[model samples]
Target: MAGDSSFDQDKNKLAEYETSSSGSYKSSRGCFNSKTGELMGRNFFSWIKLLSFFFIFCGVMSTLFGLCMGIFFQTLDYYIPKLKIEDSMIGSNPGLGYRPAGGLGFKTINGDYKGLSIYSSLIWFRHGGDGNFDRLRENLDKFLEEYEPGFFANQGASLTKCDFESKPKLTDESCEFNKEWLSDQGADIKCISAEHYGYYYGKPCILIKLNRIYDWFPDPYDINEVRNHSTMPLSLKNDIEKIYEEKCDDDPNKYCPYLNMVWLHCDGEDDPDKENLGLVSYTPFRGFPGYFFPYRNQRGYLSPVVMVQLKNPTPAVLMNLECTAWARNIRHNRLKREGLVHFELLMD
Candidate 1:
């Protein structure tokens, strides 16, 4: 009987221990735990405390970064850059660029940001491809529209009527560039915007302009030196001579009208390409007038443009056309496409 009594007491103690254990386990998973975590076996209060610290830390870091950026920006001017010339990355070399542009500001690679396409360098299309030439003409018109008269007049900036002789430069002023200068008062129809920029006839027009350098001016080619140059292209030489004669020829003693021009010349890159590239023409003296330079980051500065018309590019041939800007200061590196632009032209 005593043994039976002892066994019953032991079984009761075991039952009591099991009930306490079950209650503790349920409480640990529900809202609190005593083993280690204070709540839900995951330390809910501790996680909340850590997350609050992280949030505050992120906020403080973001605030500091924004404050630093704001302070840096406060030291800058909107109109002019802090660095100039040798101190600047451009280092006085103005790169040549062309328009009738394509494949710009467009790309997709798993939807991340990247730069322009290599195909943008080529102007290629079939003769009768649907909407091809129309798109090209539209591009020209849109690009040239910025250069038209009164385009920059009401833009809250002063316009100076610049000339190579009298007004050769600007002081906080931008030149009012005229469309007449682009086509020589409608003499060059091949490059005129109304001619569809030569796209209607499958002979396209390209406009070249210098990428601006702040307060930078071209050191022009000497008139007397270029007068009887041996190595210079014939067409550019003739154009320079004509301008010099008309403007500064009469004055024998006083050399007032310097040949202040950033001259432009275009041809095929190679012999076979040149053979395929037919007669080319540049209107408005084949150069950007030096008076239009020394870009000062004026609100409405219009960099002078040189219009290049490929009158008869060979059909069904991929010809590499190169246009270079000539000046004493401009550096040329064909491999780098510096001081010049290289593009492919094709017609079919």
Candidate 2:
């Protein structure tokens, strides 16, 4: 019985020694040991750590590539001339807009014109009623505030006194037509307020003005060619000649000889007579002249204001108007150009 117990103890000690030796060999040789499963667990954790590092490295590289690409495109856009159709240039073309546009006191006379037609139909009218004149004044005041803040102030026109709590009144001095210089040259400042000009002739009108762009100058050669081109209609040619005779007196040095003109055309395909009348008559009978002062980086220059009073038109007639600033560098191609503002007038 003693010998049996001693033999059992010796067998247990030998088994423990074999197990320890197997574990040591597995660890030193970097081999899997199925009994413990420790080497398998270590290898699984090592693979997870390696995959995590690879994913993190890929994420970092992708972010850096996106940032570099964005900067490159932005830089390229800045240096390139914008194509007007694509609108992909650094500075978008300055747009022309109307005042008292889609606001209180002005209501659309007809249903909204949609799609490509809306761009040509900017104005709608209703019969003159109470508050019309006041609303007109208010709208004009807002327009000047937005587009020409310093215009009246620069022209020595003063605002009416008002309490700090109340809105200030715009005076006649500030809003009235005071083109004394043009008047002195015998140019008619025909488009003042409807009341001042006798409203019986037409409806009270809103002012149509161009947004300011600094340092813009018309190309003189282009202006002369367009004005005197043989393709110009006979009536239009006569009108141009008459304007030069009356305003500039055939003198190149006098009052803006190369006036930047706005031409109005009927949008419909069937109006051949209206289209044939040529560019001169399109000048708003009371608004922007065929030409404007050539702005040559003049300091503190104020653009001229164009007030348009439409004569009673056949109801629901939409007029397509385009104001083009004729400069040599200002091209008018559909793909790439600046220097034109398009709008539509609808009379009801």
Q: Which candidate's TM-score is highest? A: 1
Show pairs that collide, candidate 2. Answer: 120-344, 259-291, 260-291, 260-292, 261-290
Per-residue lDDT tens digits of candidate 1, residues 119-205? Answer: 678776665444256656666778778776667657435677777665555478777677666664544446776776777676677
Per-residue lDDT tens digits of candidate 2, residues 1-348? 999999998899557646785566445445664554546335667878988999999999999999999887776554223343234332423334454454332234575422223222354444344222344344455555523334533543432222212332322222223333111122232334334321223343445455444323333333355466653334444554555565454555454432434322122223642352222212232223323333322333344555444444444555555444333344444234244454454444
lDDT of 1: 0.75
For all predicted structures, in order, the TM-scores are 0.78, 0.43
lDDT of each: 0.75, 0.42
Off by over 4 Å in 2: 1-95, 103-121, 130-137, 145-190, 193-206, 221-224, 227-237, 247-301, 333-338
Worst 10 residues of 2 by lDDT: 180-189
